[model samples]
Target: MLTRPISEGNLLTEHNVHQNYRPDVDGLRAIAILGVLGYHAFPGEVPGGFLGVDVFFVISGYLISTIIFRSLEQKKFSFAEFYAHRIRRIFPALILVLIVSLLIARNVMLPNEFAVFGRHAAAGAGFVENFVLWRESSYFDVATTLKPLMHLWSLAIEEQFYLVFPIISWLAWRTRLKWPLLVAAIGLISFLVYVFSSPISAFFSPLSRAWELMLGAACACLAPKILAPKSAGRSFYGSSFSILGLFLIGLSFFGSLTTSLFARPVLINVMATLGTALLILSGPAASLNRLLLSTRPFVFVGLISYPLYLWHWPIFSFWTIIEGKSIDLTSRVLAVSLSLALAWLTFQFVEYPIRTNKRAKFRLATGLAGFMALAVALGLTAGHWGRHYDANIQKIIDAWDFAGYPEPPGAFHDPKYNFVSWRANTENEILLIGDSHAEQYINAIVASLNSSADRPSPQLMFYSVMSRFGIPQDLLNKIANDQAITRVVVSYFWSIKYGSPKIDYEIRCCGTGLFQTVGTKGGSSPSENEMRSLDAELEQLLTALRRDGREVDVILDNPFGSDLAPRSLVRRNILSGIQINAGVALSRAEAIERTEPYRSRVREIATRVGARVIDPMDSLCNDTGCPAITSDGFPVLKDYDHLSLSTLIHHVGYLNFLR
Candidate 1:
């Protein structure tokens, strides 16, 4: 998230970045970046943590707009010069982090994951990550946490604003229009677009987001008239505005989630933007500006904030992927600490040395241009390479069928099926319903009962509420209408429907269970109220099914946390080779423990609903732990969780549950 440019206030120094440097602005920069860091590392701890990006946008607008205004007034404005400063400010640290994250990705990422990283990395280099992500993301697809370069979306918006807006401002200022009023008008329109436009446009459209930055630009354009030296330095209005500014910025932290769903054009986002503007106009002479906001520690963070932002996300994302769970508090802290240290190193060794040297401008331009070329090549090559690799991964996945039953098309047709295919089985005695994880075992179930009198046919829900609620009424009616259907096997990954607090919300859809009546965002643990609602709904559903004389069985969630799977017990052979977090084998108790709270809770719900609990570990685990690898040594879990069909059929007792 660094060579994310630092405070716009500091940019006035590019004619010299250090000589005219304002420490108070650096403090503000520190606040914005820290808020972001806190939000990423611990989202529930800071639900509105994303408002920090809005804060940065305002600071950038103020600083860049100020530079342009002064140059234009003196009749010496130059687009070449403005963009040169941007390159110096943004390119060096950005390239450094891109290289660093790619190195890590090559070492650990699955072929598919690495390919996605490459694609987004290329987008980041081109300053269009926002568009790529916008195009890629859907309401139910491409979740934010899954994207390693996700935070770069804001940077794309910021950089695009820099590229396009200054020219418009220059033209408008050259006209009879008052510069401040024109900018404010544009800001008002943009804010309206953000509020009224579709959410996709609001999230990714530069037009919608530009207003936050323009608010800063307006303050810069009007500052000289409204906050003259004598008036700013000694006026009581300066101190009062500065104090109000600080309060509003702080308020977004506590009261943002309720201020509409998207993290833009909302009351809290506007508050943070206006807050930054007020502080900038308050003049450095304002006491609050100099005393608390300009403290050395804050300024220090600001100094390295760009690189810190760049490094933190990839580190946190990769770590979460490897751990296969929500980052515990300790791991989150460690990731942040490592990010700070690496950022400091990158800033000192890469950004500072190159950006500060006037004589190095030619060298800086050449280096960045070359680096840009390399980043693009690296991205394309990685993607091409991973594409080949994924072909093999898919082939392996294709082979995950049972001994006798052939795997159906991974994707299917039919409106009733929705996304995946759902054929009424020759028997149609058992209806398998849920998301993708629920589909993983269908082949195994089919193989076990291929010739049995009662066969389990899959009715894929594919996605949770985002598609349809648990087992759509249509599918239920189909089952109810089938006289041959004597049993209903309700198996789903409950965690997918009801997100787990154990996983970060950015990575997950939501923590609320599928049965929950009240919906909430993806940051905190599921509320007791939601859980109660879920249980009540399940009870009612089960009651209805029993009244129809059909036996019901609910499969609990599978134990997750195997991103570091394929674990080998013998880290060091007799020859003493060192091994890290390699292939892992977990016990039965630990497997059950891993699925806890939700696992136990699901078990309770099943008991209450008179449904039998079909726990997979009964077959996979005995008195000992569940071995991650089979005796033949193939890893049991394919990715983080879902067992391959062969593993489930051969080892996990797919036949027992059918009866």
Candidate 2:
């Protein structure tokens, strides 16, 4: 993620309020942008570079607050003029990026991918991209690298803050409120939310991010009182503070490599924010500020930093999408180089003229607004139109739809637990328990039973659990109270629960035109404590189920990897159109190797609890390999791991135990 700093030279020019430009601040911007660029282009080398966004937030807060405070004191602030300036400064580069992204996406993306991109573009235009991305960070969401506009989330947060903060400042100044005290109170509440909220919310929520900006605001409000009438020894103290600030920032950038983002976000954010504030407090004459920050190269990068941030991620993302996998170092370097060239061109031709043209400011603002509205319209239209595969290609695309499950006629929601259930004519019942891995088999069980006229169908009750915990009390009570329930089926995506390293497999097609698997390892494994907790929870669940005198059957997790994903089998080229590679498969030996730890752990527990162990690999794999597509050309997996509706209905008979 990256954020654009406020334009220091133009902040006060609207109101004829003079503030000296700090070249060191521009130097600081150079550091922040470079950090973000390093993280996106070479994550392994610069793991903590994402903290750059925090640095930008502080810079934005200090610069924008300074302008507002100074104009208020002079009684020259106007809401209309302030927003017009914002439009001029921020809109040109943003509008250019949005239009260009939409154009590129229309040609390169599949129908579903295009639809998703359209919605994201609309969110970006509306300044709600962060909320859209937050909601999409779920089990079934597309991979992050596939999205070109994902970097807009930080821009959305900054714009959202600007929308409300200026009004609050105006009201506080008008009423003669203690601005510093008010800022501190609001900032403290936001910081608490950042510290206590869920990981996803803490990362994307505006409330959780506001405190970083407030640190800069506090500096602006108190700088006059603290820095005025400097003593003879002030220069020495300034140099020391500046040096310490740089050290803290450098430490956070490198220290984050070993730390999980969710494990200690408070420490990382605080170091970056406080470090930025201290550097500003140290004044321009500080030794480091004069020698390092005021250098020409640093200031030049700082000047074009906004456009550069907007350009880099999309270039890298598109490259990944086109190549159908993680790119090589040469590709990354070329992308960065291309982004720099585009950013410099955009600043020279598009941004500079629009921002500096004082006489046409009103017209330029109005035109930019109109163009933004048009971008939103185009995005909405794209989403509404959905996928547009050719008739033959569409049949292949339709086979991957995960929602093709046939709903049973008697299906209804359980009033007590709010889960889906269906009653059969007979008194026999089968209770399905666990996470989504269990739910995926519901339709398959129904289909299997319906086709088998000789057997009696049982009532299906699914209990979906989000985490790896033992069956809850409410679920246990239902089993105890219902005598008709004779069978219990348990399943889960156990490799994920038992902390297996995620490996993404890509089916690539190039000049060779031969489909081959390329695997890339990602995500961290769970700690020893987490693994122990999961083991204990699993044992408790099985023991309780067996104690009820029911036939307990534990179905092992299915063989899955990115190679099995439907998207991996399909590729789009501008000249050739859709290319389907249905021969993609994973070797049975490798599948077993990947899932052996989970299978061994589950088997040991089930054996002790007297539960029957069922393995899906018995049907999904053969002596050679497990194919992503069936013999008839239907996709087996909807995503990286989840079984498709078509797969459950026709490919495997593992769930026949339910009958």
Candidate 3:
């Protein structure tokens, strides 16, 4: 689709001769880059600077649309040629950035985290980073912050949009239909979907993002009509609109992400998008465009913007991983400097050589394919290794069976401790059910059960099945014997901490808990169905046990204090010279008071179910105030609420209440 350079004699009008490059376009690039940089560096600096991506999106749409429209109008529409231009323009620098960053991170990141990087790298090469990111959002894990290629989700959205836009453009040409209307409708519908599903689909999910790209496409189709020159006076309006566009963008950057009431409140994106379009159309005519973007340095940066975007994130992420630090102003500056250096090198050495040379296509294709295959293989290997490690750890947790204990470790070393297995004989056995807190104490209970102290633990077979929020009775029946098992222990942690209204609001607003209870009044209450289901499950278990003349013990929840002491004590002991006593520290009456509410809830549930309630709060507290130091000088609790293994082994002597 390449057009021969227009000779002076071939021009239809003198206006073509006077046409010149626009400097303001470069200034626009500077605006977009600065906004994006500020947003990433200090998020509060420009709340909506994230929209800078929308600015770039519009520019790409306008430029590419112009090129495609011009080529088609000139009777030059070759798919192979179109794709070649795209490959040369995008891949060379992207591949270089990925390779360099992967090498750097491979050496520094933990194996599990490094494996995730490799997988994302593969997804990026396939131009589906958006899909990968969409899947990751559900977990909302800490692992996400470490990914540098996370930003590539936007690139994926743009590429996918372009892939389909041209075919529609070509169809419009062949049929001579109202292509703009059809295209605009597509953009509108995509935007509606985006508005409906945002924050959920924020950084990923192309369906929600197609509108941004299409906004540019629509601008392109309408360009010939809107961009026609008028008079010198008209340039004033054009320049004013251009400046106005920048002002709107600046305003968005300063606005809050939460200000909009309507879904997605995409008005912000729309405004910035419209502004970018105006900026583009204003070029070739508006004096502001010519004066702002035509500078040598600005043009240079714009030329390498693709690579700059690709390199910045990974370098920043790897730096954070290496230093075990957060992203601060200093880190932002370093990241930007490193990104610029890498982008310049990539553009000059890799992109230029590959794009300008025709024969280099073969070499480029081979290298790309080989690199892709290698990355896939390595990623698969790493993933398999991680899965295997998880399996082995899970087995240990299951073997430990921590569900029966009053409190379980917040972080378990073994995954096996998670499961409940049947005794040698599955028939006529006890089954345990509840959420993680119930599961957490399984090991100690199992240990106590196996001890010669409690009726040979009844040769009891236990099933550790439980739900996080509530359990369904159907699953309970599936695991139960026809006749009641010897005894069943039902357990869960009952704490206001779990249902605190203020913590919920903070979590919804700031994406994290605020460390205080949201008093009981403000939050939504649990549904009747959830409560009924829990009640039904308990009643069924009790009925079945009674019919078989079996005893049932519903373990009362252990207390959960601030969950701060253990973490605090460990940090102090490891980092400082303070010889802290953990036991007395953990056993303080005040420390025990924090868990009293959970114990009360357990007692309430026990009364409702006519089951025995086991309260361990007194074991952890005395008549006196809670002591920060345990009598043994071991931190009283392993974590803020749960006793450590050593603490548990010591406390086992006091647990004769079970006997």
Candidate 1 lDDT score relative to the true structure:
0.67
Candidate closest to the true structure, highest TM-score: 2
Error of 1 at 433 (Å): 6.3
Question: Candidate 3, residues 1-659: lDDT per residue as tens digits?
Answer: 11222211222221111123344554666667767776777676577777788888877676566556656666766665555556656777776666665666555543455677778887887788888877765322333445778788888887886687778777877776664775588788878888777675854777777777777767667756766655531467777866776666766676565465312347777777777877776654566556556565667776666777777777766665554335578878888888788877887777666665655554565565566566556554554543222332222222221113443323222222233352333333455656654454455555555564535343333344444433456645543444534566666654432443222232121111221112122455445565456556555555554444445566654444433233233111112212222333344554545545445544665666567666555565556644433455444344334454544655534444332
Q: Find the candidate with the highest lDDT and give its number.
A: 2
Score each candidate by Cα lDDT. Answer: 0.67, 0.78, 0.56
Query: How displaced is residue 331 in candidate 1, in Å?
Result: 4.6
TM-score of each: 0.73, 0.79, 0.66
**What tens digits encode model 1's per-residue C-alpha lDDT throughout 484-549?**
556666666666555565532332222221111023334566788877777676666566665556
Q: What 10-residue stretch in candidate 2 is worst by lDDT?
A: 508-517
List the candidate numbers ranked by lDDT, top first.
Answer: 2, 1, 3
Runs in model 2 lying further than 4 Å from the true structure: 1-13, 135-143, 178-182, 185-189, 192-199, 222-234, 257-263, 385-387, 391-407, 412-438, 452-558, 572-578, 588-624, 653-659
The list of candidate 3 runs beyond 4 A from truth reads 1-23, 139-143, 230-234, 257-264, 284-287, 323-325, 358-378, 381-435, 450-659
lDDT (Cα) of model 3: 0.56
In angstroms, the error of model 2 at 525 is: 11
